[model samples]
Target: MADQEETHTNGSGDNQDSPATAKKSGRTSLLDSGEDFEVLDDVDEDVDDDLPPLEDAGGHKKKSSGEEESAQAEGANVTELSAPQEEWLDVLGNGLLKKKVLEPGSGPDSKPQRGQNVTVRLRSSLADGTVVEEEPNLSFTLGDGDVIQALDLTVQLMETGEKALVETDAKYAYGALGSVTPAVPPDTALTLELELLSASDAPDLELMSPAERIQLASQKRERGNVYYQRGDYAFAVNSYSIALQITEASSKVDISPQEEEELLDVKVKCLNNMAAAQLKLDHYDAALRSCVSVLAHQPDNIKALFRKGKVLALQGEYAEAIRILKRALKLEPSSKTIHAELSKLVKKHSEQKGAEQAMYKKMLGNPADSSAQKRQAKTSWGVSWKWLFGATAVAIGGVALSVVIAARN
Candidate 1:
């Protein structure tokens, strides 16, 4: 499932907080725009961190980097620690919070030891307590190893409707992993709290209704995209496969055929990506199967048709290659890559389409060579960095203002 996530903008700068405005009587004051914050004092002090080196409040060590920003929407708290709170702070020297356990569960792969899945929502912070990353809501098979070890440990200890703070060094989590994280140090340690809102021990049903399966599959697809961007194409293919399976199982959505077509369109693209990535890994049969799956959903898809032609060419079915390639070219005349591929096939099968195959093959070009996907990177990529700077400024200013207000204490 594709997610239309909103883009974040921070004007011209990032990491700085929005300007703070104040009014005294009829006069307004805007001195060096910054953040205004109230220091929170009543925090739970009883927690665990066996490491003796931590210097947290009451000697709690932090498991991850970055102060937890108080995100009211996600109900996830972000706070920075002085030398004191670092005990519970498990910030990886890089930025990401190594996936920590949100609940203790069975074990990786739903092993009798790992545990079951859990539903949760988290607003995350990178180093220095920046709330730039957040999963407003998410579901994981918990101990099934869908998340890091710390989150699983924390999740298992939590009862239904229970929430607690849990942290861990990145060693047991994702370490200096660069392919997925933009600036994270490879294998860096991480820390976070598990606020359990709900826990259920339901059976894992693979035969659920198509609609429900579609929803679950979509979540997998989104997670796959996040990982794919991190250059984990294999995971992306698996996630897209799950989505295609759900769609293939059923086409009726209790709606009109027009609506069904729209849903199928989504599935077609999922199948296309699955095939593309699988081919990159040299899994020809699997790639061909995925392309066929897309045609079953929507025969008019030029991309899938083109991909199918490529698969045929790989199998040395030059005659079929020329036919499918020609069809794809008719639909997308402006595609430079498609023209390149058919040129070769037309030569392999001189009599594939009698007289026209040669002409069409030249027009289709060499179907063998694939062009890079023409997709625009998320607009937020640029905006989010600027926002980060702006937010940081505001946050620092807010901290200073709080220090001034609480000096009397």
Candidate 2:
């Protein structure tokens, strides 16, 4: 949920019914004017994908292998951490309560592994204790069925421009999986180090301002970003498409190939976005072809793998679905969402195998689907003739016991 923003009344307290006051409060206040949060730079996570972040079920956030414990130790005033780090941040604190900006993400929502995501790193640890695991960026699109409940709650604390590190229990983090250590069960209490990177969708604003040529492109990207957030993949794709063309035209800006990597990522996201939109619209073949195209460029892309796997599943290619999803699992072994999906597919495949065997048995016996003759054959479920008789009470009828009772009388 988006937080309600409060605007400070200017001194002299005259009737301040001006749009300037509304604009001054940032997008947070403007949201009350019914502005779309998706169009803004900061994408909110949905409320429903309330599962653990990793597959380990170890009651802990999966610590990324890329990071290690920094020399920074012990909690300081949320404002007084470090001046240099502070420039990379904006903070809000009222004594023990505070909000700090963490990291920001790209315009397109892609796999957690591939590109840099917009993240709001937040911290609320005990003054004496240390944070056990590093926090991932949450500046991506959050919504129903996308992120864990704890993160959802954390993001909800800030209005569009507000930021804070809310001290919530393990009940919030991992939804009961408290610690990153698999040994610990869920619901254990823990602290978070949260930070908000930016409040609006102007992530590229700093760059856009310097180059006047890219202003229109930035605007188009922002609009595409909004469409992406609202689940309007088609419009989102169109918005991104226009932005891409503008970028191509604005090659005058001196950007290294490494910088170009980020732009390419945005393009991949657009194509993936288009394919996903197509997938949701049930254009299975088109989705599959689009995913294949994305994979041609980024063979290791987990998002394309997932999309391809879904397309295969829709095409009744269970084996292919299982294969593609397994590859994705290798890329992010700790991802619980992927593991859950794989589990579902595995169970489905197992059931399908059993049904196929049962069908074969019925064909050999020349029996109908509901034939009792086939039931007794034990096609995996083991519903044998004897078991069926026992279930129906067909054996040892009550008459025998009644006859014995009559004899005793």
Candidate 3:
């Protein structure tokens, strides 16, 4: 899918070779801004050695075997004083993910909720112990598509101060297209060490600054793009929907003109991308609504127009589809994608019309066939009438002859 952007006037002081210019020059880049783009090429060798021993909520550190024995001697339950279990628990029961708790956390009754902000320290490595990603402290909204599916699912199962070693299948992590930043190979599994630092309710959108909302919304859109690339259309749709919600909420708050424009641009992009994802899921009506919403704000948005046309065609509204596609083509006369879509829609429209005509002919008898049958029936009736008249004449003639003979006698 092509990335959509609004045309912005460069001020005299602005850099002529801005990142925005570079992004606009290509159709492949899903992100509108370069501020949050990340690459994880550098590996911290001391990452393993730097972290202190895992500790629970009450500052109780994980104990060694001897320490465990000492704690048991002090009347602590032997089971509770024992080291974290080495036995791996299957998290999903599908063999895709397996977890072994290294340090059990306190507060068994509390865990991160959906829509809450979660912070964790993460270290991911390949099966051979080559670290691909290491973050001292990473924070994201739980269940917001901020992280990989595996991390999201794994963290929700954790409590504050919990430490676990998780084995992840590629499908739950990066799928086939692995990270370019981390230099991970395609379809490679990884070992993750995660420590749930904390979880708290997400900040209200109204309470956040306009810039914060824009940044968060953009992050969500980028996440959605990742899901889209992985062919996870349902997840992609959810991410985009969340982005749209953030932008819509941001619009209500009093904001500067520049912020408003930026928010609108992001909103348009999210709506367009969401429509594309929804279309992939065969959600024709929802896709149509998304496209329509984009057009209402940005009438010349070629992507939105093209997608709307596609959804309409899928719904068998060929005439409207053609009109929408033609408009899109007109707006971007040089866009090969728009031209190709329009051509396809036209072909489909013609085929659909032909099919409809054939179906009507079957439902209502064909005019030519009807006329021929009528003529055949008319000719048959004429022959029968002529035969009846001839028989009557013969009978009448016989009767008259008999009467004449009687008079002569």
Candidate 4:
């Protein structure tokens, strides 16, 4: 699965709210653009720690530096905490939030742009020194709203390998509503210790050379394969699609004949793999399109043909599926994959035929069995002529007796 930004609160405060605490009420606002916020009465009373002691919400205590290394030596999961060393500086011109850089980063020499994916490890806490979130690692694009506005803005000022402590007032933290996590109270400030692990620009096919583009596409395809193996079919589809796009873009570039051929081959493989992943995701139309793209380049590609046939079968186009699978089988007569798919299509066709026939019989009452079935049904219900004839004889005898009595009277 693609690494998603997870909200984790660090410290002893990452659990249920203590009964001694009072819930704050007011309009909560994220600390963005130096926005003004209403001050809550409980901010001082609830914040008890002079310099907050970091705790693990994962039910583990914060270990000493030496103990942490020793535990790591024994193969234990160790949570590393960064100590605050520098005074905080206002992030914006206003003093709504502050940042303290622990270590300067080296990178493109500039901060990240919005929409660029940023990978980082971070720990978040309240101003009173209670850890609210401590994530070992997470990946999120700037301006995506996947992370809180405070951290999102803070990352914009960060470079790869930079570690910094960011402090946001209650206005910027969870505002009044707090976060989805119940551990975060309303009108709480948040402090974050963040380390930028990596920053990457979006994939641009136009600027990359044919070789570079091909290599990049191959990387995407590899990433997709990993996602596919992890049962993340949707992400796998996306990864393969990125590769396909990269190759498609590379086709327009001025390149040698060999490179062009390589690009085409890569594109074909990407399309095929994308179709396979789409099939797993039940994206029938998309999978079919990928297969069609593959077939456009290599009409005799057995994988594409088989994938197309499977997609058709999933859509209940059994006849078309059979035709396509047969074509594939003829190209590679010994392919077990094609043979199995063909068998499945044939079985589906037979089952569909049987179901249709059964439905027709039910709706139209089976003309072939009409007369005999009617007779059998009558016999089963004792509605035969013999029963009618016996009733008629009894009625006649009753009528004759009644007439005789009336005449005697």
Candidate 5:
């Protein structure tokens, strides 16, 4: 259900506009403007090949390890085997969730942890066996809310290569507002046939190929977009943060020039989108950092500059805000959005300066009194200069008279 949420992609062009502009224009956000990465095509193709074929509801046919080894040693094709007896276990003890193990998994002790990434094949159906959803290989991090609550909880109880039929109450599945894609009615119970293909800890970016890193990062960004559209700003921020981490770490891996460019683009998108989400949450400092990260990569990115300016203005750093908005305007001179934002920022900056000046005048007593004191000081200086000039003129006149008397004698 989480994966089925709507996703908005970030666009390629710098003129696409920021989320603030989108809001003014009655558009959703900058996330709504771009092409999404085709991530489904990057999923591992060998997930189905590793699993044994599904058996009928009666049970699955099995072979002992020793028998399999012996048959392999003899070069004999072992096809038919005795069927394992069916057994259903109450997963939650409340019977709201139950699991029927069709085939036992290998490495029984290595079950998936809560945060581990798990890939599984699932077929979800209604009580009457109407298939609502079928995924050949769905990979998601456990406890990450990538899937429904029922699937997340059920997967943690299964191991690699395990195939089980899970029964879940509506409370654990889609609840009242059942899924729209599969058209599940309200309060419907789901019967899921799940095959846990593989479960592992989250991949370390340094060890992954460049393409893999980009794919994973793009998926995280896409998930963030979904969360953003759903107004889950906190989760959206978390997803974007993870994507940023992946992209940042990918720099250390050996990658082609083209891959490097793509990685940087993804990084910029994540940062810009993260800034938007953080702004929604009122995490001004974090949002400012995100925008700064984007600008560090692409200085002329109009969205980052716009968002950074907005964040700075929100934090009352109006001078820097004005500078950033002006920079963004220089990049996209004709952008009405940038123009409008710069206008607002300039006005706000002026008003803010005016308020500060007023506050200082109030702190220092009446500004009118200060002006009068300055005027009085200027008048006193003027009078002192006038008196000195008059004294000099009188002295010079007396000296001239004395000289004239001496000449007459």
Candidate 6:
């Protein structure tokens, strides 16, 4: 579900009026102003032909004996930790909260691993018994950000049929900014009851054909979109990245040119979306890189250009921002979103220019005063040095005359 776009008047979010905002107040965003993506013409999809083959679920193909021995040695270097005998465990390594298993079940083997979808029945509320959210069934891949970080960590530590109450501070639950729905207000502590229904491994990527990979990538893209709409930028980034990884991997597999084009298109969309998430996280450099990648394939991509311009604007490179945004406006003349953003940049540029002029004037002051001060300092230094030299010469002459008079006597 896409989060309904809302105008924020509280001045407590990203400064830019883009569709998305960062977790903190007064940052910039790369999310486009609610527009469809501009499709690009086909490009060469075999860009990464030199990369190594991805490992299958079983394992990588056999290499030379030396390489195999080396891999074995590296594996030997790894030491696995014994399962925790202590009842309480901290999942994220930070001391946010301690998870003590309410009822222990079948151990590690029964637990779900990363990339496996886990289904759970969730009931959440404030410490004061105010219900925030409840769902009879909710499913999310482990290690994915579909659920809150703490909950994701907690469930992975439990087995099927196990139920646990995870207590977390407001920081881990909602942080400073609340959810899009305002159901979980900012900085509100939460108690969640999670009943693990089942866990199953997702389809193996390496075993899948090119078509299957494309389908999976699309699914992940949709999931990412849902997360983006909810204003969960971090989760959204994760989903997009997974989708991108799948698309790239699909491109590597033996596929026809048409299939490659479709995968590349999906890849481009993922990059664009991931850029938006990066913007909301205040990751300007990453967002710019994504835009750069998109533009490499599609120069006329309005979203890419607009996002790039936005990133430049946030970085205070108003001149470049204006140039890029103007180019985008040419591509989309009637787009109020682009037009509005361009106006903002132009206004920002004017303000910046005025500020620079004021600062220069303040430093230089009246031209006459500046020149007078410079001349006065120069004159004083020059006169002082001359007088010191003259005094030394006179003293030397006096000493020479005294010596001559003593010799004559």
For model 1, the stretches where C-alpha displacement exceeds 4 angstroms are 1-117, 121-188, 201-218, 248-253, 344-409
Which pairs clash in model 3? none
- Give the runs in model 3 whose Cα sits over 4 Å from its true position: 4-85, 250-253, 358-365, 369-409
Return the lDDT, model 2, position 35. 17
TM-score of every prediction relative to native: 0.47, 0.36, 0.70, 0.50, 0.60, 0.55
What C-alpha lDDT, on a 0 to 100 scale, does residue 90 get in candidate 4? 64
Candidate with better TM-score, 1 vs 4: 4
- Model 6 off-target regions past 4 Å? 1-98, 121-138, 174-190, 195-200, 209-215, 222-232, 251-265, 315-319, 343-409
Residue 48 Cα positional deviation in candidate 4, in Å, after optimal superposition: 22
Candidate 5: where is the Cα deviation over 4 Å?
1-108, 114-117, 125-130, 141-145, 161-193, 200-204, 250-254, 369-409
Which candidate leads in TM-score? 3
Winning model by lDDT: 3
Comparison by TM-score, 5 against 6, better one = 5
Across residues 158-179, which tens digit of lDDT does each residue of candidate 3 receive? 7689899999998777767777
What's the lDDT for all of these models? Answer: 0.51, 0.50, 0.74, 0.67, 0.73, 0.71
Residues 1-409 of candidate 6 have per-residue lDDT tens digits of 0111212221212212222333343233323222111222332333322233343224756699999899789889678744434345554555665565566555556877777988988888988998888888888878765556667667766778877778887655665556654388887778888888899987667777888988777767766765665576776777889888888763334788998888888788788777777887789999999999989988987778888999999999999999999998999797677788889889989999999988887887767778999999999999999999999999999999999999999
CA deviation > 4 Å runs, candidate 2: 1-221, 244-256, 366-409
Write model 4 residue lDDT over 1-409, tens digit each, in one string: 0110111111210111111221332111101022222222222323322243454225576799999888789766556666544556566657977777788787446567776878899888766788767788788656543456678777877768988888887666666656545268878877789999888886556867889887776666655554444344565666667667778773445799998888887677667767766766678999899889888898987777877888898898999999998998999797666777788779889999999999999899787699899888888768667788899999999999999999999
Clash pairs, candidate 4, are: 8-133, 9-132, 9-133, 10-131, 10-132, 10-133, 28-176, 31-172
The C-alpha local distance difference test score for the whole of candidate 6 amounts to 0.71
- Against the hidden true structure, what lDDT does model 3 obtain? 0.74
lDDT tens digits, residue span 1-409, model 1? 1111211112110011101111112111100111111122332324443234523325455534333433433454545433322233333333332233334333232321233556755544444665433554556765433454456545544445443454455543454352243234565544454455555563443455445655665555555444343344565565666656655664333556664564565476577666655655667889899889878867866666776788888887888888998988888787555677788678767754565766775677734332322122345566788899999999999999999989967
Rank by lDDT, highest first: 3, 5, 6, 4, 1, 2
Model 1, C-alpha of 151: deviation from truth (Å)? 4.9
